[model samples]
Target: MRLTALGSRLRTTAWPIPFVWTVALGLWGLSREGSVWRDEAATWQVALRSTGEISRMVENVDVVHTLYYLLMHSLFECFGPSTTVLRLPSVLAAAAAAACVAELGRRLSGNLVGLGAGMAFGLIPSVQFYLQEGRPYALVAAAAAVSTLLLVALLQGRRNERGRWIAYACMILVCGLLNWLALLILPAHMVTLAWARPTVRTWIRWASASVAATAGVMPLILFSRTQSGQVSWIPPLTWHMLIGPAILLALAGVGALLDRPGARGLSATAVGLPLLAVPQIGLVGISLFKPLFVDRYVLFSLLGLALMVGVVLGALVEAVGRRSRSSARWVLPVVVAAATVALLPQALAKRSPQSRVDDVLAAAEQVERLKKDGDAVLFVPSARRDTKSVSPHAFTGIQDIALEETPERSGTLKGVEWDAARLRTEMLARQRIILVTDAGDVSKPADSPRDRTKLATLGECFRPVVDEQVRGRRITVYVRSASDSPSRLRCSESSR
Candidate 1:
């Protein structure tokens, strides 16, 4: 009995193992070979701004990421800016999440299940993708895991119930502030409440805590509606997106069946099943109303999936133990090892530059290489201005001929550009123009009149001196055609 007690104590402290393991995984290719995608470029730019600038920018756009931007801003102030400093918070947050999953599994199931779940959390593909990302999703995932652990502790009728409830509410609040979509976890917890069938008092306490947390984030939710255009780029829901959730649900369902959780118990299925399924289904439902079904929105739900994986591993151990006790001991390690080996290629790929849609730094490098002295730069559709915003050094002596206001001063991303009439007047004075834009395959049709004008004017008045495509971005150097007189430079612009 003492030996069993010793084993239990040792297992409780085993969270650090997964924590360390996840840290190692996160640090393995921490910089992604010094690649930063456009999304991270946004983070980097906003984070480098003053708090007042961030406040103004959020009021105009991207209010959803305000808290994360402020957090990163503070980090930047303390550490200065570098790829390591940019992504280190995510690495630490992911490690904390892995540790929380391990502790949750240990308390709810066993030491082995806890360790398996914790380790499995790091290996999950979505988790791995965002694990090194310099964004708030990983931090939200960590808060969600901590909140779930607190909820499990509350359900277990542990001491310090009041304090745990407060912590739980704070965790939810943090998650919501990071990204309000994380409030979906509340419905997930509601499912757990139904499964556990807690007493009236417990339910009231849980309801109060949940309500308090939601109320804290409600103002942000309402305010963000004004900035809804940030998400307008998300396409309408399609059948193909359903395949991923369907497979996830099917796998979790099998794990639930294998665990066969008892009614009204804080069993693995009781917590994990609801955690895994409810948020995903809830997001799908939201998508039905508005196309907001991004997989990363409910990334916290991966914890539920990891817990279920642990249950599945536990089931395998039990089945194998019936045949040979010694063999049962090998079940988890062997399975984890085999899974790791199978995922080796994917793991390496996630650490590569090609893992993302585009590399902002690589594009900046292309600008540095192709740029000649006194060349003026133009960003097609304007958003590509992020390349210059993220790497201002590469753009030294390069004029943004059309920019009317800087992004920081204008309280907007990508800054403000002159009207097409003024833009053409400005462009006519420039001898060499460096055009930075998306490559042909990824470039969207120029929607705004200004963008259309930029394209048409360049096509009519300039000849391509050098054009190169690298890492999903295109750099073209256009020298004004001497044969083209100002009369011939008359380019038509879209009326709208």
Candidate 2:
């Protein structure tokens, strides 16, 4: 009687348990100790722009992230800018996602399953990484979870079918607007409807909702193509990348077998399997043509993995109860506790500044320390100007010698750069220059005429006096004698 009462109370309040748990996890290191990486730097710089400027800038580039930028603009206006303000939305979104996952588990299976899945969602490595990130993916995942819950409710013939369908369409539209790749969830839902063997009416309503959302996002789909070059840096899909998805699919498959599901009726397998497999397979199919197979793009699919894990946990408890009913109740809590212990190191590391690829703020601090007054600053390939854009105060006295126009004025992320001849002319006049670029491990050779000119002119005229690589950025202070000329110092002799 006592255990039953506890279980009933837990089910009644299941959503908050995971909601609070995930929020706590997200806030544990919300600021990453004031470190912001390049990707978040994009968010920071763009979010700080005025709405009109952001609108104009997205017209030329990054239209895909327009809604997110606009949303962040409002948040920045309301909360004054800081790393906490920047990342707190993601934390809240992740918590909402966890709450939705818990409710979905409860509806589809039972209270314990829902609670376990919701709590497990926070512990997943990928979810943990993005929970505190200043990006749109967590929001997309939260929207996906809500839409899936609505779909399940509709499948069960819940009340207010009409209103549920509208809410469902809105969530899907939100996901698509945030990222069109998220439209892949529609097919996953289609598979779930097929598995459930819904009536023709249900199929038609589902199709109508899905099509409406897709149509709403079609304009963005068409417009983003003009800005496709923004993703040109995403490497082609390879066998190495397949390893992670394959392992995930294998684990979900094990959960399906443990589920011992029927061919129909909204089993966890019916929903979870398709959600896990379809989007991954679909991404691979698209990558065949465009090579845009980044896992973060399809992050919503992690909910399916969480669901499958819930199924396994629930089944394990049930089997143990057959032998000893008294023992079954403690199984899940113990497993969760053990998993928490095992993940402690990774959880701590994820909160550290070193977790990201590079810390732009750390690099900015280095530039402040290494710079001399009146030093001319240059960003090789020009995009490295993001370091300066993000922390303009650090370069307060320095001149951007190669910049032709500011990023805002040019409606671009890194702004426009001077022509090659002008860049060379400017370099010749400077006695000392602060050259900022990527670290040696990640740096590529100059790919543009102007960037090549910057490097060549530096190698032939100046010698690197203060060479420091910090946090994935190389800030080299190059000095040249007033009498130095290309003839006096060869590019081969600089050793820079």
Candidate 3:
């Protein structure tokens, strides 16, 4: 009797542990002592821009992220900017998601499984990747996980629990609005409903909630469709993508089969399996038909994988403990410690600028050092002309000679481009010119009409001085000399 009561008390008291760890881990490098990437800088830039500018910019581009941009705008207005202030929302969102993962695991399985699952989620690499990001993804995951937890609660409760059902519906809307991709979880949720043969009233409650969520996001969904070009860069499905989901599901599948008693209903396997499997499989399969296979977009799906893994790990630890009674207590802790050590390198890497592909901070700093007073900058291709958006302080003294309108004035992320004649005039105005372009563009034809105008003029009118490559881009500088000739630098209108 005493042992049984003690077990129950421990389970009740363990709810806060996962949340505490998540917050601590999420805040580790969130202050951004390292470099800030373009995407991170984008959140800062868009939020602080005058509301009207942001409003106008989204009308043509970035319509999908408008809601998130407005939320950050309000946040900046309320709290003066700080690195901590900027990313704290994501930190807290990750923590809440971790906690919810634990709670859901406990509801579906039992105490030990919940603890393991929550810890797995808090430490999982993908979750850690976005935990401190200023973007909407971490919050999207938290909202989706919280909504699923509520669904689990409703399924476990009495059919009369209309309050839980209603809240679940609202949460679905919040999750869906946070990121449209999150709505994919709803179809995976059918697995849970299928597992429970509910009464007519329960069926009615589920249908009503599902309909409200679908209805809530229809307008935004329509708008996002028009902005599909934004994600046109998403590549078609590949072998690596197929291999990744297959591995996650295989581990989760094995765990489901090995789950021991004390785990609650069929809900653990039913909910976790579909949550992990359906989104990845369905998304990839859909990608084969269309092109939407970016892994970061579905980061929340890992929580399902972690939950299932926790149950499996818990069962394994317990089984080993029984088999080796003398060394039982040390076995699980040692195994967990070993796993933690293995994950330490990835966790440490997240603290550096290397966490992102392009270090906008570093690239901007290099530009600041390269150019002198009266020098003009040109962003080739015009589509990536948002360098000033990354480091306004660094670019403040430099001029963008080829830019027709500033990104904010033009109400666009990349800013409006100058026509070839205007660009030639702009280039002629400054003797010292600095050019920045994507590193990937290096191998493109140097003399192509679209590209050669900038470089051709550079070679004819000036002498090459510095050519350097940085984190995500390349920068080159040239200065006018006695050998310069305007006629040779000029391009015909037909070429343009």
Candidate 4:
């Protein structure tokens, strides 16, 4: 009796083990020696900005995920905004997501499937990257998992369960608010329910809840549309990249369908088809315009992929067992164990700490030492530049011109509009300006013609004071020429 009780307890407790592991790994990822990356730095800046300022900032800026910023604002208030503290919420959320994935797998398949999916989730390299950052991706990941589980539950139910319907509604609403990409799951859910032969009342309840949720989320959708207009330079998507996830998803489907036990054909079709098909179709549609087929956007699909693999593998083991009882008994466990062993190395490497925090802090220190109360410090284009080549490799705290203009390339700064006249006014007011640019190697073309003029103008107004090399990158400091006026320049209204 005691042994049976212990077994039951272990079965129940298995779901949370992966969650604990994910959290521990996330914490380790956070402990890595890195400063906040560009997007993370931008999130911190926005969170720190005053509410009044945020309205003005958002009007000109293109930020799709404002709720994440709002949450970060609350976190910053509570924890006082250190990089580690700032990222803790995302790390926690990612860990919770892994737990949810495990639970979903267990409910749909069995304990072995659950364990494999959860461990895979905790160890996935891409998952680790987002978990370590102070961004919305991790929260989006958690919401995606919850939304999927609720969706599966809603479809499987026979009657109108008020609590389940309400839960589904809330999950949908939260998913929409957290990340717009979550809308992709709605059609998948709908198709799954339709195929399940749910009762008429169930359909009505689901429809009503969905419509109500959409109404609630309409304002945010409108805000996203308005914000989209500000980003004019986003390039159209290509066909090859859009179809990539579909192929990966298809592999998962084959694994699931071929491995299922008797009478699983309908269940497999219901879950697998929509999960794989909708994203592929959506990707094709989205690719025709600006490509929204980013890997993280379809993060929810990973759950389906894992489920498909687990079911197929489980079936294979069961099949071998029927042929020979002794062989079958050990076959499944050995396969799973071997798969786990193969995956362990990649998992450990993903969570390693090497974020390069020392670089940004060092640059901040240098700026402090060089700056005086009245001295002007101008980012050449008045935008943040990539500082990856510099020691402690991270983004400098300089603001970017706007999100629309941010470069598609990673580890480089682009899209800052420089106004020479405006720069001159600020410099003259302070009697000197410390001009900083990313080391030339990583600096891309300035975003505006005015930015190029400002670079040329800088040499004319100031003499180089210090040209130091740190971490193989040159950082030059220039002091204003003696002939330049201490008073600020007065420009025409148009110039300003």
Q: Best candidate, lDDT-wise? A: 2
Clashing pairs in 4: 32-353, 33-356, 34-355, 34-356, 34-357, 35-357, 321-328, 359-392, 384-399
Listed in order, each prediction's TM-score against the native is 0.95, 0.95, 0.91, 0.77
lDDT by residue (1-496, candidate 1, tens digit) is: 1123323654746699889989998999999989998899999999989999999999999898989999999999999988898998999999999999888877777776788888899999889889899999999999999999999888888899999999999999999999999998998898888888899999999999999999999999999998888888888889998999889888888888877544348788888878888898888888988889899999999999999897787777777777876676777779989988999999999999888888889999999988878989999979999999999999998899989999999998899999998988778777889999998878889999999988888888788989988777899999877654565535322211
What are the lDDT scores of the predictions, listed in order? 0.87, 0.88, 0.75, 0.59
Better of 1 and 2 by lDDT: 2
- For model 4 the TM-score comes to 0.77
Please count the clashing residue pairs in each candidate, in the order shown: 0, 0, 0, 9
lDDT of 4 by residue, 1-496 (tens): 0122222444776568778877877787464445554456566666665555555555545445667767777777777767787788878887787777667656555555565567657655567677777777788777767776776666555255787778777777777777766767678778877776677877898788788777777787777776675445445666556466657767776765564332212354466457656755675676576655567666655656655655665566457656765565465457656865786676555444323221344444465556555554445444443332222113243322222243322211233333555544444444455555555655567776565655665565567887654322235666656553433233212224
Report lDDT (Cα) of residue 160, candidate 3: 47
Per TM-score, what order, best first?
1, 2, 3, 4
lDDT (Cα) of model 2 = 0.88
Worst 10 residues of 4 by lDDT: 386-395
lDDT of 3: 0.75
- lDDT, candidate 1, residue 27? 95
Q: Which stretches of candidate 3 lie over 4 Å from their true place?
A: 1-9, 158-160, 260-264, 323-332, 440-452, 484-496
- Predicted candidate 3 versus true structure: per-residue lDDT over 134-252, tens digit per residue: 88888888888988888877777745477888888888888778777777888878776776655677778888998899899888889888888888878888898788888899989
